[model samples]
Target: MAKTDKQIAQEVLDAVGGRDNIASIAHCATRLRIMVHDKEKVNQTEVEDIEKVKGAFYNSGQYQIIFGTGTVNKIYDAITGLGVEGKSNEEVKSEGKKQGNAFQRAIRIFGDVFVPIIPVLVATGLFMGLRGVLMNEQILAWMGMTPKDISPNFILFTQVLTDTAFAFLPALVAWSAFKVFGGSPILGIVLGLMLVNPALPNAYAVGNGSAEALKFFGFIPVVGYQGSVLPAFFVGLIGAKFEKALRKRIPDAIDLIVTPFVTLLVMITLGLFAIGPVFHSLETVILTGTKWVLDLPYGIAGLLIGFFQQIIVVTGVHHIFNFMEIQLLEEFKYNEFNPIISAAMTAQGAATVAVGLKTRNKKLKALALPSAFSAFLGITEPAIFGVNLRYFKPFVCGLIGGAVGGFLASLFHLKASGMAITVLPGTLLFIKDIGQLPIYLLVLAVSFAVGFILTWFFGYSDKMAEELKRAK
Candidate 1:
């Protein structure tokens, strides 16, 4: 019998020890993120067995249940209606921080600040990709025109699509960071704008020796923080703190005017003079170190990163990669991390496919196939928690597949034009260069084949399915 939404929600609540035990409830993309008061009262196995529950696992101090996209919202609504209050994602994250250690909390913060900023970047990347296609020499030749024949105004229009986001990227980052840190987001945007004010020397121009930095007090070199992440992030963080501190002391009558004025002035000064210079350098150093590690000889770096990336996901710290990806795009105009991680994602999905093909249990097979499809679209929690992680061996096999795929990625020097999107949708990132699409497809194919083959032969059998069923 098909279970109604209410039934599913109630079962989920019951499975996790009911309304009283849930300290907080939220949903993110594909999972029901719940913080329960007592882990001892929750039944992990039963939760996985619930209708529409793809899988369940404890991560970052929250019991996350996979329900896929679209469906998660319905379930979340049903759960919230049943006499249990629903917390916003940020509020739930706050509750979760009380339980997670330092590293987990930091990763969660990274996700909170950066995830909202990704859509604009993805759209810009797609625009860049499409522009690349339109401007391709071969494509232009087919249209009986040379590159020089294209209108200057049209070229400028393309630049508007491609360059605007990164040009004002600090504003976006600062706005999001301020909101995350509990400050006035508008103030953060204003502060971020000050960092890239036209009066200051452009960062790219300074890098290229076309322009010089302005001398502040004859020694401090002040330049516009164009395409910079850390400066904007710290400015937002400190600005939020400063604003909150001012709010406590300011009188209610003039609080609104006084708080914003003081916050913007102090933050802009610190951002351009103190925080901007220091953190930009730090961001550069970090990016340089990351590139060095990723550029290790003979794809060894790829092998290590690919094999262990999923394990990091299991620990719920993988959002830390957002910083690396963002920095890579800012520094090099290309993201090497995207393709490597895409390969890792592909391998996990392939492993799930193998499980679906091999499992004789109807219920398990039903769960595995759709989860694998979801993984190909670049959501891996379903495949990982529902299928790959169940047998352990398949998970390891997927890691091996990912390592090989990543090794090939490095050897081929695979790079994506953007971040956020991966696997099937990630193909759009490779469309800029003529041969890149084929190579990217080849990498995914190899990852899938290796993952599927290995898991099929050695990672699973009918016996394990029988055992899992008996245990249930």
Candidate 2:
């Protein structure tokens, strides 16, 4: 008999060593992220055997189980029905800080702050992609118009649709950061607004030499924090702590009035005069360092990341790279990270495709085909867990394919205008530079071909399925 979602959730919970062993639970777009009190108590083999569970793995101190998109929500709801409390990302971050070392905690916090903000950015990115498509000379000529003849109102509308969020990105970041740090989110928005006030020149303009620094207190430098990340984050942290500290001394009667007043007064000054400049420089240094590494000669750095990327995905911490991708878009206006990572994903998908075609095991074939499709659509957990990682050899083969693709990508100087979307849909990114699109196709083709051929040649055998009992 087929198991219901409740039973699947129950089985998952049981396979995770019961509700008592679970520290916290949450779900993302495709997986259940469970923080466990004891990793050793969890039976991975049993979890993999459970009905409706596609795959499972441990990474960033969380036990992640794949149920696949729409279904994961049902199972998550079922788990909640069983009296297990599902925590928010903030709660998960708080618990993660307690359980993780410094680096792990940092990664958790970064994910926490940015993940919530991504939906808006993605919507905006899609609009930007649309605008890119509309601006294409070929597209324009096909539409029987030229750039000079295009409607100004349409351009203005696209500008607002595509650019407004990124222009005032610090506000969104500050709002999210304050929530992550345990503060009133409304107050965080208020502070974020001040950081990007119209009175101050915009950060983007400052970069183009259209805006100059305004000195405060006769010596301290101040500029708008528009589109910046570090400044708002730092201010939100200090502001949250300041607001909490103020609430302690002020009497309850007048606390609301006085606390916000004092907190904003002190924190805004700190942000403008001290915190903003310092952290902006730090953000620059970090961005510079990343650029330096990613740009290494002969695509050496790209080769390394491509080879190990899927290995990192198995650990479930691969989502953290989105932050790096977004930072690339914000700082450099182009993402070099996506091409290399997409190469890795395409290779994984290719390996799964080869396995599906070569395997006589009907069960493995059923899993491999859809997972490969998902990987091609920029989701890889299914491919990595449902097929590649289990066989081990195929995953390594995929890495080799990815390394070759990344080298070719680097050699061709591939770039993307946005992040968060990849593979087939990522073709939208190269719309403005149609010449680069074919080069990207070449990278994907090479990656896919290498992974498919390698996996078909050595990744599996008919006897192996019987040995592993994966045969239907």
| Best of the candidates, TM-score | 1
Model 1 alpha-carbon drift over 4 Å, by segment: 1-14, 27-30, 68-85, 88-90, 466-472
* Every candidate's lDDT: 0.90, 0.83
What's the distance in Å from true for residue 348, model 1?
Answer: 0.3
Model 1 is weakest, by summed lDDT over 10 consecutive residues, at 463-472
269-372 in candidate 2: lDDT tens per residue? Answer: 88888999999889888888888878899888778888888887765466578767777878776788788888999999999999899988676787789999
Clashes of each: 0, 0
Candidate 2's TM-score: 0.87
Checking candidate 1 for backbone clashes, the offending pairs are none
lDDT by residue (1-472, candidate 1, tens digit) is: 8999999999999989989999999999988999999999998788877877777888778888988789999999999999889989877778877676887888888788899999998998888888988899998999998899989999999999988889888999999999999998989888888888899999999999999999999888899999999899989888898899999999999997899988988888888789988999999899999999888999988898889999999988898899899888877878899889999999999999999988887877888999999889998988898888877888998999999999989888888888899999999999988788899999999999999999999988879766865886
